[model samples]
Target chain A: MAAIPEALAELVSDMESISDRNERAELLIETADRFGDFRVPASIASKPYPEDHRVKACESDAYVWAVDRPDGTLDFYFDVLNPQGLSAMAMSTILAETLNGQPLDSVAAVNSEIVFKLFGKDLSMGKGAGLMGIISVVQTEAKKRLAAR
Target chain B: MSVSITERGYVNPGVLVSTDWVAEHQQDANVRIIESNEDPLLYSAGHIAGAVQVDWTRDLNDQLRRDYLNKASFEALMSRIGVTHDTTIVLYGDKNNWWATYAFWVFQLFGHTNAKVMDGGRAKWEKEGRPLTREIPAYAPTAYTAPERDDASIRAFRDQVLKHVEAGGPLVDVRSPAEYTGEKLHMPEYPQEGAIRGGHIPGAKSVPWARAVNTEDGTFKPAEELKQIYEQEQGLDPNSELIAYCRIGERSSHTWFVLTYLLGFKNVKNYDGSWTEWGNLVGVPIEK
Candidate 1:
C-alpha cells in the first residue's frame, strides 16, 4: 500500500486512541459542524451539480469536486444536498481537511478502511458505503490527476 | 400546506404525532421522546430538547448476532432510558423517520404497543425552527419490565418468506426500482451486507418506500394519497396478508408502519432479512 497522507494518518490515529463511543461521536459531530466552512464555493460549483460528480450509493446526495491547484496538488470540495446528512458532511470535511494539498500519490493511496478508523466499525453497511463513496471519489480524482501527468 | 395528522384520514391516526404536538409534549413526564437515526453523529450534534438517543445498532440490536436485543436487554435499555411500562415513546429521526420507524418496529418485537412515530421526523422539526440541544438529559432509571419478544406477529424470517413465496402471497418490494429490477447489485466493497445475486422475490410488487412519504418535508403522505399509491397504483389488497421487504428491513419497516397503521391493513409483516437473505439463499425463486 502507498503511504497514507501524514495529516490523514494522524487524524486516524487520534480517532483510534479514543475508546469511548460518545467521545468519538462528539469529535465527529464537531467535525461535521465545520462542514459549512469546507462547502463547495459557488465559484467552483453550484446547485444542480452534474450527475457524474455525485457519489454513488450515497443516500445523502453528496457531490465532490476537485479543483486543480497551481502546484499540481488538488483542492477537494464537497456538497451534501441532504441537510440531515450529518455523517456525509463530516466525512466531506475530514477529506477536505486531510487530503487537500497532499501529494497526489499519497491521496490516491488512501484506502476506504480509513473510514472505519475515523468513524468506527459500528457504522451500518449503508452508512459505511456512503462514507467510503466520498473517499472513493476523492481518490479517483487524485488518480486521474496522477495519470494525466 | 400539509394536512394535520388527525385530518389525514388515517385509520390509526394516533400512531403519528406532528412536530407541533411533540413541541407541546417535550416536557410531559409520561412521554419519552427518543431520537433514533441512521447517522451516528446526528444525535450527539443536536437533537430535540429532553429527547434521548437510542442508537439502532447499539441500543436495539443484539451485539453478538444479527438479531435484536432480548427481553432482559430490552428491559435494561428501558431502565437505562428511564422509561416505565406506560411511558409513551415518540420516535423521530433523519431519513424521513426511516430509522425511527425501524426502532418502532423493534419496540413492537418486544410488544411495546404504546409507541408512535413523529411524522416528518427530525428534518421537519429542524426546518420548523424548533429548538435542538446538545445537552443530553439524564432521567432516573425506572423499574421497567418487558415480555419476551414476539416475532410472530409482525416479523418474517427467511423460511416464512419462502413459504409465502411458494403460496403466492402478496409481497411488497420497498427498494428502489433499480434494486427491484436487479439492475443494481450490492456494492462490492461491503460484501457482508451485499447480496451476490440481484433481483427481488418472486411475485413481489415494487413500490419504493419513499412513496409513502411526501418528499417536500419527509412527512407521510395523506391517507388518500397513500391509498392511491398502494391500492390504486399497485393494486395491493388491504385485507390480505401482506409482507414488505427492503435491503435490510429498515426501509420496509416504514412501509409496515404505513400499511398496518396508516392504511389500516389488518395483517402486515416486515421481512427484516429482506433482499440480503433472499437474494443469497440457495434455490429461492427470484424475479427481476
Candidate 2:
C-alpha cells in the first residue's frame, strides 16, 4: 500500500489528539472559514462546472478540479455550491492544503477514514458520506494522474 | 415570489413560520429559536443571531445504543437549551430543514407539541440576506420535565412495518429512486453500506422527500401542489394509516412533517427503523 501523504498524516495525528468535541468543531469551523483561499479560481473553472467533476452523493453540490504541477504533483481546487455546506468546504480546504503538490502515488492512497479522525465519530451518516465523497474525488484525481504516467 | 405559509392553503399553517416571523421573534422571551443541523461545523461557523443549536447525533440520540435519549436526557437537553413547556420552539437548519424536521420528530416523541419549523430553513433565511452571528448565546437553565417518549403514536418499529406490509397498508419510500430500485446499495462513494440488502418494503410508494419542497428556495411547495403529488399522483389516501421511511429515518421525518402538518394526514407515522432495519431483516418482503 502507498504511504499516507506526510502532511495529511500529521494533520490526522494533530486532530486525533483533541478530545473535546467543541474544540474540534472550533478547529474545523476555523478551517472552513479559510475555504475562500482554496476555491477553484475563475481561470481554472467557473460556474456550471462539468457534471463529471461533481462529487456524487454529496448534497452540497461539491465540484473538484486538479491541475498538474511541473514536478509531476497535482494542485487541487474545490467549489461547494451550497453556501451552507460548511463541512464540505472544510474537507475541501483540508485536502487542498495537505494533498496539493504531493506525490501522485501517496495522494492516491489517502484514505477516507481521515474524515472520522478530523470530524470525530458522531458524524451523521449523510454528512459523513458527503465529506468522504470530497476525499474520494481528490483520491480519484490523483489515481487518474498516476495512470496517465 | 412564493406564497406565504398561510396563503399556501395548508391544513396546519401554524406549524410553519416564515423568516420574517423568526426575525421578529428572535428576542421574544416566549420563543426559543433552535438550529439543528447535520453538519457539526455550521452551528459554530455562524447561525441566526441568538439561536441555539441542537445537534441531532449528540443531543438527540442516545450515546451508547442506537436509540434516542431517554426521559432524563431529554429533560436535561431541554434544560440546557432553556426551554420550558410553554416556550414556542422554532426550528430551522441546513439541508432544507432535514435535520430540523428530524429534531422536530424527536421532540414530538416527548410530547413537545408546542414547536414550529421555520419555513425554507437556513437556506431561505440566508438567501433573503438575513444576518448570522458566531456568538453563542447563554441562557439560564429551565426546570424542564418531559413525559416518557411515546413511540407508538408516530413511530413504527420493524415488526409494525412488516405487519403494515402484510396488511397492504400504504408506505412512502422517501429515498432517492436509485435506492428505491436497488440500483445502488448506498449513496455514491459512501463507505458504509446502509444495508446488506437493497430495494424497498413491499407496497411502498416512491415519493422522494424533496418533491414536497420547492428546490429553488427550499420552502415547501404550496399545499395544492403537494396534494397533487401525494394524494392525486401517488394515490395516497390522506385519511388512511400511512408510514414513511428512508435510509435511517432522517429524510422520512421530513416527509412525515409534510404529510402530517402540511396536508393533515390523519394517521401518519415515521418508520424510524426505516430501510436500514427492514432491508437487512430476514423474511421481510422487499420490492424493487
Candidate 3:
C-alpha cells in the first residue's frame, strides 16, 4: 500500500505560502476529504532526530544522550535538564546497565531510580520489558508469515 | 438496527475521522480542520494547506491565571472557534501527537464528541506525502450548542483529585521522570523546581507518556497491549477511577484518550491543573 496518497501530496508540497488561518483550515478539510482513512503503523509517525543527541552533566543540569552501539540504529536518548547533584558517572553507569542488560550492584541500584521509595528502581526496565514483549510477539508473527509464504 | 445507548457513546458524536478520511469527506461543508500550532507567525511559513492556525497556549488558554478549563471560558472558546456540535472538527499540532491529544481532550471536556485527534497528526499527514497547501480557507461562524457538561467524564479541580486519592483511585503521572520526581519542573522556564516541591502526588504512579506509544509514529499502542501495560505494569485497575496528569494536563490528556477511547476504561479523567497547579500550591501535600 502507498504510504501517502497522491492528492494529499500535492497539498503538503505547496503549504509554504498559506497565511490566513481560515483558508488553511478549509484546505485541511479539503485534503482530509481526499485522504483521511489511511492507516499506518503507530511506530512510523514521529519525525526522527537520531543524529542530534547529546549528554551534559553539571551541578544543576544533567542532560544525557548516548548511543548504546555505534551502529546508531537503537540509541537511547535521555535529557535531564536539571540534576539535584546527581553524579555523571553514576548516571551513565545506570543507563548502561538499564540499556545494555549489565548487572547493577547494590549502591548502583539504590541510586538508579533516584526516588528509590517512589516509582521503584529499574525505571527504564518497563520499557525494556515492553520492547522484549513486542519483539517476541513480532518474531512469532514473522515466523507464521514466513511459513505461510 | 438502532444502536443501543451504551454503544452510542463510543461512536464519537463528532468527526472522529482520520486525516485521510477527512480528506475524502472535506466536501461535507460543515467540517473544519484547524492546525493548532504553538506559533501562528511561524505557522504562516507553512501549515496543512488551507488549514487555519490556532495558538493553543495563548489563544485557547485563559492566560490571566492558570484557570483554562473552566466551563464558562471553555464555552466561549468553542463559540469563538466557530465550532458547533454538528461541525466535523479535527484538531492537530506539531511534535507528533503531543498537542493534538490536548486539543482532543479539550473538545471532549466541552461535551463535543465529534472531535478527534487526526491519527499520526500533521507529522504522518506530511510524511505520507499528502498535499500541504498555502491558501487558507475561511469558515462561516457556526452556532455550537453544548449539552450539559459531562463532569464525570473529565478530571476537574484539586477537590475531585483529592477525592480520587482518598478513594484509592489510580492517579497516573504522564510526565517525564524529571518532572514527576521534582528533578526538573518546567523546561526552559520557571526555577526548574518542577510543578511541585516534592515528587508526585500521593498514590500516583509514574508512567511516562511516551511508553504508551510507539516512538516512531504518534499513534497509540495496540488495544490489547495498552490494556496489559495499564493493568499489569502500571497497576491500573480498569474498574477503578483512573485520573492522569502532566505539567499542564497535556500529556495526561493523551493517556485519558487511550484509557477511555482505546482501552475502554469506563471511568477516566484528565486532571486539567496537572502538576502546574497541583505542585505550585503552598500547602498541598506531595509524595516522593
Candidate 4:
C-alpha cells in the first residue's frame, strides 16, 4: 500500500482531532470553503465534463480531471458541485485540496475514506460518505496513469 | 389507480395527493408539504412552494442515540416543524424518495399517520417543470398529541429478525445485488465492507430497492407490476411473516413503505439493524 500524501494525512488528523459532532460539522463547512472556485479547460467550457471517469453509486455528479504537471506531480481538478450543498461539497473539497499537487502514486496512496467517520448526527455521515465514489474513481485513474508509464 | 394514489400508495391513501394537488392545497388549512432530501442542503437550492425542510440527521434523529427521537421530543419536533396532529403532510425529495420514504417511516414510528410520500419524489416534479422557489413556509404551532411510538407492529429488532430467519420466514434483502451475494459490499455502507463478515443473512431474498421504482421518474411501478414483481417474479409470500433489510435500514424503509402501504401487505417489519447488525454478528449464519 502506498503511504498517505503528507498534506492529506494532516487534514485527516485535523478531522480526527474534532471529537465533537457539532464542531466536526463546523470544520466540514470551513473545509468546503477551502476550495475557492471552479476552473476548467476552455474547450469543454460550454460542454459537460466528459463522463470518462464517472463517480458511480453516488447521488451527485462528481468528476476528477487528471493533470500531470512537468514537475512530476499529478494534479487533479474537481467538479464536485453536489446538488445537496455543504455536506456534499465538503468531502469532495477535502480530496481536491489535498490531492491537487500530489504525485500519481501519492494520489494512489490515498485511502481517502479516512475522513468518512468524522461526520454525521447534526450534519450526517452520508454527507462525508459521498467521497466514497470519488475515491474509487480517482485512485483507479491514478493506477491507469502509473501503468501506462 | 389514479396517479395520486399510485404515487402515495393506498393506506391512509388520502395523504398521497398529486403535486398539482399540493399546488392547489398549499393554502388548504389542513395540508403541509415537507421536502426530505438525502442531501439536506438541496432544500435551499429550490423547493416546491409552501414546503418545509426536514433534515433527517438534524431533525428526525436523536442527537445521542442510534435510535430515533423519543415521543416527547418527537412532539417538540412536530411543533418545531409546524406539524400538527391533524396536518396532512406530503414528503418529497432527492434519491428517488429514498430519504423521504425513510422520513415517512420515522414519522409512522411516532404514530403520525397523516404523512404521505410524494410519488416520483423531487426528480419527477422537477422533470415536469413544476414551479420551485427558495422561499420557506412558516406555520403556527398546534397542540400536537404524541402517540406511544408503536414499534412492535412496524419495527423488527435483531432478535426478531434472527428468529424470523431461523424459522424460514420471509425476508427481503433490499440492498444492491452485489451486496446481497457478498460479491461487493462497496457503496452505501460505512468506511468499506462495513462488516468484516460479508455476505447476507442465510435464506434472504435479494430484491434490490431500485427494482420497485421507475428509474426515469422515481415513481413506483404500477401496483399490478409491483404485485407481479414482489409476489410472482420474486415469489415473496405477501401473507407470511415478512421482514425487509438494507445495510442500515434507510433503503429498506423504501421497501417497507411499498410492501405495507402500496401492496397492502400486513405483518411486515423493517429490520432497522439490518445487514449492519447481521453481517457483523459473530455467530449469525451467513450466505454468500
DockQ winner among the candidates? 1
DockQ-based ranking: 1, 2, 4, 3
Reference-based lDDT, residue A129, model 1: 94
Error of 2 at B240 (Å): 0.7
Residue A58 miss distance in model 1 (angstroms): 2.0
Residue B219 of model 1, lDDT score: 93
**lDDT score, residue B200, model 3?**
87
Off by over 4 Å in 3: A1-149, B1-16, B39-42, B69-81, B147-152, B186-196
Candidate 4, B26-143: lDDT as tens digits: 7777878889876644676578988888878777777786778888888887887687877888898888888889989999898888888777788778878888886767788767
Encode model 2's per-residue lDDT on B1-288: one tens digit a residue. Answer: 789999999999999999999999999999999999988888888899989999888899998887889999999999999999999999999888999999999999999999999999998999999899989999999999999999899999998988888999999999989999988786544444378788989999999999999989999999999999999999999999999999889999999999999999998999988887887788888898
The runs of at least 3 residues in candidate 4 whose Cα sits more than 4 Å from the true structure, single-residue gaps closed, are A1-52, A73-75, A78-127, A135-149, B1-15, B186-193
Better of 1 and 4 by DockQ: 1
Q: List the pairs of residues colliding in candidate 2.
A: none
lDDT by residue for model 1 (B1-288), tens: 688999999999999998999999999999999999988888898999999999988998899998999999999999999999799999999989999999999999988999999999999999999889999999999998899999999999999988998998999999999999999888887888889789999999999998889888989999999999999998999999999999999999999999999999999999999988988889888888
Candidates arranged by lDDT, highest first: 1, 2, 4, 3
Which stretches of model 2 miss by more than 4 angstroms?
B187-193
CA shift at B192, candidate 4, in angstroms?
9.5
* Candidate 3, B46-116: lDDT as tens digits: 55655655555655566666545566666666676667777767777654566667777776767777766
Clash totals in order: 0, 0, 52, 2
- The per-residue C-alpha lDDT of model 4 at residue A17 equals 74
